[model samples]
Structure formats: C-alpha cells, structure tokens
Target chain A: MASTHLKRTSLYDVHRAAGARMVEFGGWEMPVQYAGIVEEHHAVRTAAGLFDVSHMGEVEVFGPGALESVQRLITNDAARLIPGQGLYSPVCLPSGGIIDDLTVFRLTGDRFLFVVNASRTERDFQWIAEHTRAATARDRSADLALLALQGPKAQSILERLTRADLTRLASFHFTDGLEVAGLRCLVARTGYTGEDGFEIACAWDAAPALWSALVEAGRPHGLAPAGLGARDTLRLEAGYMLYGNDIDETATPLEAPLGWTVKFDKVAFIGREALLAQKARGVARKLVGFEMQGRAVPRHGYALQAEGRRIGQVTSGTFGPWIRKSIGMGYVERAYAPPGTPLQVEIRGRLEDARVVKLPFYRRS
Target chain B: MYPKDLRYSSEHEWARAEGGRVRVGITRFAADRLTDVVFVELPAVGAKVTYMQPFGVVESVKAVSDLYSPVSGTVVEVNAALADTPEVVNSDPYGKGWMIVVQPDDLRELEQLMPVEKYLGLIGEPAT
Candidate 1:
C-alpha cells in the first residue's frame, strides 16, 4: 500500500529521529524496526523494549447494559471478569468464524473497553455498535495512544517513572488514572509478547513525552525502541497469534487453536451455538505449531506437505531468533495435528523437512 | 557505494571477474534494503547456475527474497560460513559476504552486465 496516504502516529517524529525503518502497517505508517529486528528481538527477550502500539484501536462501551452487550458480542465470558480484570477473546460471526481476536477490559461494573486490531478497527466498531442493545459504544482510537513496555526489566523501568505499585498488579489486570511519567494514563499489566510488561494508554498529545521518559528511564536496563518487526517475532515466540496472519475471518476459534477463548458454557454469544455444534462434532481442521528440521526458513503462504501431498498451508512462520530455529503455525487436518508428525514446508519450490511440535514454540520461564 | 572494479547486475548482484572464474555477491544496495540478513541458502558447489536465474535464497526477519545468479556458470565454491553467520552478507556484502565462486560458461556474458555508474543509476543511488 502507498504510505503517502497512511496515517502517522503521535510518535512519528520520535521514531524517525531514532532512524526507525518505517513501513505501511494496517493503514498507519509505523516503525517496523529501529536498530534491527534481531537486535531488538534479543533485547526484549533478555532485557526490555519499548513499543508504540498506537495503531491499535480502542472502543469503550458504557451504560447499564454494557456487561450484557459485551457478553453477547464476544465469545469469552466477560461477566466472569470483575472490575479491573481483562480477558482475551475472539469476536465471531454467527457461523463461528472469527471476526477479530481482541482483549476486553472491565473498567467498572457498567463500563468496558475493547482493544481491537488496527486493521479491523472500523469493522469491529460497526459490528459492536450494531450488536449493542442499550449500551453505547464509542471509538476512542484517535484520542488515545498506547505504548507497550515489555521484557524482563519492564516492571523496573516503569516503576521508576510511576508511583503506582506495579508489583501488586497481576497479569490481565489494569489500573486507571495512573500517573506515568507525570501523565495520566491507564496502565494494563498485559502485553502481546510473553514477557512481563505493562501497556500504557495515554492521551495522544502526551505520547511523545511519555515515550521519551520511558526510554530515558529504561536506558540503564538495556531497553531498546522496538518496532513492528520485533513485535511480530516476539509475539510469535511467545506463541501469541496475529489476527491477520494467524487467524482471520474465515477461521473459527475451535479450528484456529483458540478454542480456549470460546466460552461455550456462557449464557449465549454470537457464535456460541455454532461453536457448541463444532465441539460436539469435533473440528475438522486444527492449527498446530511446527519447527523446520533443516535450515530452510518456512514463510507465510508456503505449502505444508505430508506423505508427498499438500495437506495445509503455513499461516505464520519466522526464524525464531530466540529459539535459534525456524518455527511456524499452520492449520491441517485433525489427524495430522499430533506433535512430532512429520511434515514438509514447500519454500521457494523446495520441500524442506519439518515436524509438528507444540503450540507456543517459545515460552517465558 | 559500490566498488568500481566489480560488474553489476540489474538484480542487485555483483561479480568480480578473475579470468574465467568470477566471485559473486549481493551489492551493498541490496544488503541495505534487506536490512539484517538472517538466513541464506546457497546452491551446491558443483551445481549449474543460469544467468538471471534464481540460484539461492536469502531471508531477512520479515521477508524471503530469491538470489539471482548474475552469470551462468558452474558453482565451483560456496561460502559455507554464511550458514552460521548470514549477517556477514549485510556487514560485508562485497567482501566476506561473497556467496559463491563460479566458472563462467562464457566470458562474453560479462560484457552484458552494467558498470558501476549505470548500476548506480538503475537503483537511483548517486554514483560515488
């Protein structure tokens, strides 16, 4: 896509000044790398890394029926979440096909926030608006900028700038009205990368100052300003799924390795019935992780073969720098989903040996 | 900037002809654009390579691009070091990053390749 018309985040100047390589990502001109992908990836794995995730969209649902509306719209049981808690879930079509995978944060008993993918912001907003009964949904994307401080030292780096007791904040929980770098922001103890981190959402105009402060505070901790490239590799290593690359509108939670996110026991959700039926009959296809047995790097759209026949296609693949090996995820027939099953990835017209491993090729200790 | 002594291919490869044997590697331009070469798959040492044909593959963190042979030849020697240190292709594209040494099928094909000035123009890089 032409980057000329792409939107720039509030930290555009900062990224440019740092010599970040900018690319068109989901309608936004975002940094894909700063120093380099591998360097930034290692930094996050070993120390800390800061990221501008302002491209992500946030929609706030407010009213007496907010909880009910969220429960009906998302596959996860939002009602189970008390105030200050968040949960990852897939918003699905009536057919059980995934509309978007998102995180829902319960700010209060009658207020909630849905953090949706940047590419699906408009669609998600429209879908939620249409499905909302008495609740009101407002798109807060443009007004807010999100930053992720991730890695082993993320807590230490953030704690230096904030008075909030980050040690008490558990995973998947958020605190609002927190003063980060002297700027009021919502701090969520969550991240796409498997590392311990906090995602801070602050006013758009205040993002530059907040980012500068975090970078300054994190310097002693070996923090680097990472970009989308490292973000992809880090999340993949952590076994987190990318919405467009891993799961899309055509796949359902059951088949996309996200069955855990589908709360079948919930009262009723958009795709609950279809998912329940699929559970009863068993899903025909399943997403599985695999590792290349050879040096060849598996890539997205590469054909997955078994017994000399094309059985599936790689949904997402990359050389896991942290793992020091090539790993990927793909959907194949249920019978071939077993770990250790022999497979081959057709890369550049050559079939390279691989085997089905387990999901989450890498996990934090 | 590209080395003036090397001949350039439109596909961003460079060749240093020494008699009938030519050393080949991707240019500095290609390396910068690729930004951190993570993996490289080279043709077998004895394999036949055709001009402008894909003889190998190079992968960066975000992309996989084919490495086109700058000249048809027999791959007499491959840079085995790249298997463990692919970033050399980025760090020293014209030196330690040399991918393969080839015995060209025809010396006349060298005349068809572009000189440093023309190659720089093709990529819109100011000639140094």
Candidate 2:
C-alpha cells in the first residue's frame, strides 16, 4: 500500500512545551517521548504515564437504531451492552477477518460511540457506515481530544481530581460527565497498558486544560507524559493487539488471538457465518509471544523460522523496556503456539533464537 | 551546539579533559534527539572499549540506541546512579549525567576529535 501522510493532535503545542520529541505516526505528528521510552515504560509499569492519543478516531453512531446498526456492522454483540458500558470488538470483513479492532461505548440506548485506531479511521468508518443498514454514522474525529492515563498508580491520580468514585468503575465501563482536572470528560476505565487506568475523552478546545491538569496531578505521583514510543512498548508488553502490524482485513480475529470478541452466537451478523465455519474447522495459525535468547531486538515483519525453515513473520517486536531482554509477538503454525517451542527470528540477516511463551511480558502486583 | 572547550566525535559522543582522564557523555544534540531517556546501560568499569564500538544502550520511550565509544580507552568508572533514575540524562546530561570515565589508550587520539567550533561548523550551526 501507499504510505499515507500523518495528522497532528491538539496537544502538539503542549508536547512541544514539555520538550517531547515529535515523530510522525499514522500521519500525526506526535511525541514519541519527552524523556525516553524505557524510562516512560518503567514509570507506567511502576507508577503511571500520561498519553495524548487524540489522533485516534471517534465516530458517533446516533439515531433510533444506532446500537442495533453497530451490532450488525461489527462482529461483537453490542446489543448486550447496557448504557454506559464499553466493549472491545472487531469490524469484520466477509471472510471472517477483521477490518479493525474498535471500542464500542453504549452512551445511550440509541446512541453509541466507537473509538477506532488512528491509521484505520477512514476504513473503519466507511465499513461501519456501509454495513449498517439501520444506523446513521458520523465521524467526530475533529471534535474529540483523547488522553490515556495508565499504570498501577493511575486510579489514585484520577481519584484526586475527579468527583466520581473511580474505584467503583469496572473494566470496559465508562461514566460520562465525570469532572476531572476541572473539566467534564467521558471517562472510561479502559487503557492499552493493561493496568488500572482511564481513557479521558473531552472536547478539542479543553485539551490544554486537561493536559495541564493531568501533568499537575501526575507530578506528585510520578506520572510521566509518554510519547508514542513508550505507548507501543507498554501495549506490546501487555500482549494487547495493534492493527496493521498485528492483524488486518486478511487475518481473522480467531486466527489473530481475538476469538474472545467474536460472538458466533450472534445470528447473521457480518462475517458471522464465515467465523462459525472457521471456528468449526479451527484456526491454522495462532498469534504467540516469543522471548529472545540473544540480545538482538526483533522488529515487525521479521522472518520467524523453526529448524531453519521460515514458518511465519513477526508482526511486532521490540526490547521489553522493563525486562531488558528482546521480546516480540508473531503468528506461527497452531502446533507451535505452545510454550517452549524453539524458533529463530531473522533480524538484519542474523538469526536470533526465540522461544514461545505465554502472553504478557510483565504483570505488576 | 558545541561548547568551545569540548571535543566532539561523529558518533555523537563528547569529551572534556578533566585532570588526566576524559569525562565522556553524549552531546546536547544527541540527548535532544534521544529525548526522555528511560534507561541507560553504562559500560562496566575496567572494560576495554574500542573507538566507534558500541559501549552502552540508551533507551528512550520510543526506541533503543547504542551509545558509541568515541575513543579507545579502559573504562575506569560509570554513573551507577542512572540505573534507578535515567532521566538525569535529560536533566543534567553534561555534568551529573556523564556516562563514563576512561583512561585514554592514546592521548594523541584526542587530536583527531573536532574542536567545539569545528563540530559547530560540521553541524551547520554558527560557531559562538
């Protein structure tokens, strides 16, 4: 495919003020980090880190049949969602493969908002609108400003600023109109870090106020303002999936380790029949995490080999900032998903030894 | 920008002769590029380092980069304080954040390094 240009977020000036090193990601000029990736990674692992992810897409699906339409368009059973709950689902293609991984937030009985990845924003919207026979979909990308406050220390930092009892919030649940940092936000206890954190969604103009508030509250708690670099490593460490690299339209959610989100019980949804057939036959390949025996870092699209024969390609690879060892995840034959399978990843013409292991390179107490 | 008293290496390392040994650290330009240094792996004390060889890895929030040794020497000391807190690279990279101390294998090797003005010239920055 052609390389697309990036987009800049509202926090660009704020990042500049904080001395963040900017880099282009999915057409957005975003801070890769202010201090460093590993340091920011360590901070979030030990405490908390702030992330400006406003570049991601937010589409509002409103009308009488909004929830029903979103459910029909995507693979997940969104109709089961009570108001104010969020569910992670994939917009599926006809082949039972994923279009994009998305977060479906049931804001009201007839209104739902979906957050999609930055790079797949256009495609996700097009697919949702085209497939939904019942709902009216509108892209709200220009209106939303998003921040992810993530880590073990996140709850305490948020609790200090918000009037809501965030402790009562469960995973995948959001409470709208919560006051944080003197502004109202649609706060969700969902984060890519796999830690106890919240994704703060607010209006564009209030970005500066929200960013400053987070910084002030985060300072006493060791909350580092992280860039896209630390964000990638942390999400990878958590075994969370990233689109384009991890899975795309050609890779089914079942094959890409997202079978949990595919509700085959949903009658006649997009890709439901194909997914059911695939489920009956079992997936040929599975996504698995691998630990490098050598110091060489594995990068995306690197070749994975077993017994010196290429079996699969690494979809995402990087040094585990906390582990200090090279780690990556990739797809391999289903038989090779078990722990202790020996493999090699080709990095810059050198074959590095890698062994299969369970997902999640780190887990905090 | 280069300090007039400092000698620069193309590998982005800098040295300021302090007594007999040289204090080596990354230049401000290098630190600025690295940004938000999260982890610093300093060379072990007493290790013989070769010119242009990888000495340590400086990990930022986005990527990990090798810190190259600008000159041949035996590492006599390292900044251990960085292990617990690496952001010192961003805070005080020039002084407290010095990466290592080394006894030069050849004192004449220092002559090959660019003087601050020459480094500024090479980087297209007007010499101060």
- The candidate that achieves the highest TM-score relative to the unseen native structure: 1
Model 1 CA deviation exceeding 4 Å by range: none
Give the per-residue lDDT of model 2 (tens digit) for A1-365: 22355567888888999988788787788898787777888899889999999999999898877767887877778878999899998888888878889899999998899999998899888887886666788999899999999998899888888888888999999998888888889999899986788999999889889989888888999999988888888889889999989998889999887888888777567888898888999888999999998556677888999986888889998777777767889999888889899999986567878999988887656
Q: Candidate 1 on A1-365: residue-level lDDT in tens?
A: 77578999999999999999899989999999998898999999999999999999999999979998999999889988999999999999999988999999999999999999999999999999998999999999999999999999999999999998899999999999999889999999999888999999999999999999999999999999999999999898888889998898889999988888887888789988888999999999898999998667778889999998988989988888889888899888888999999999998778899999987888889
What tens digits encode model 1's per-residue C-alpha lDDT throughout B1-128? 69999999999999999877999999988987887788999989899999999999899878888999889989999999999989899889999999999999997788789999999999998878
Worst 10 residues of 2 chain A by lDDT: A1-10
- Report the error of model 1 at residue A200, Å: 0.7
What DockQ number belongs to candidate 2? 0.23
Q: Give one digit per residue, the lDDT tens place, for model 2 in B1-128.
A: 46778788987789878777888899877777776666677768999888778888886544568888877899999998887667688778787778998898886788888898888777677878
The candidate maximizing lDDT is: 1
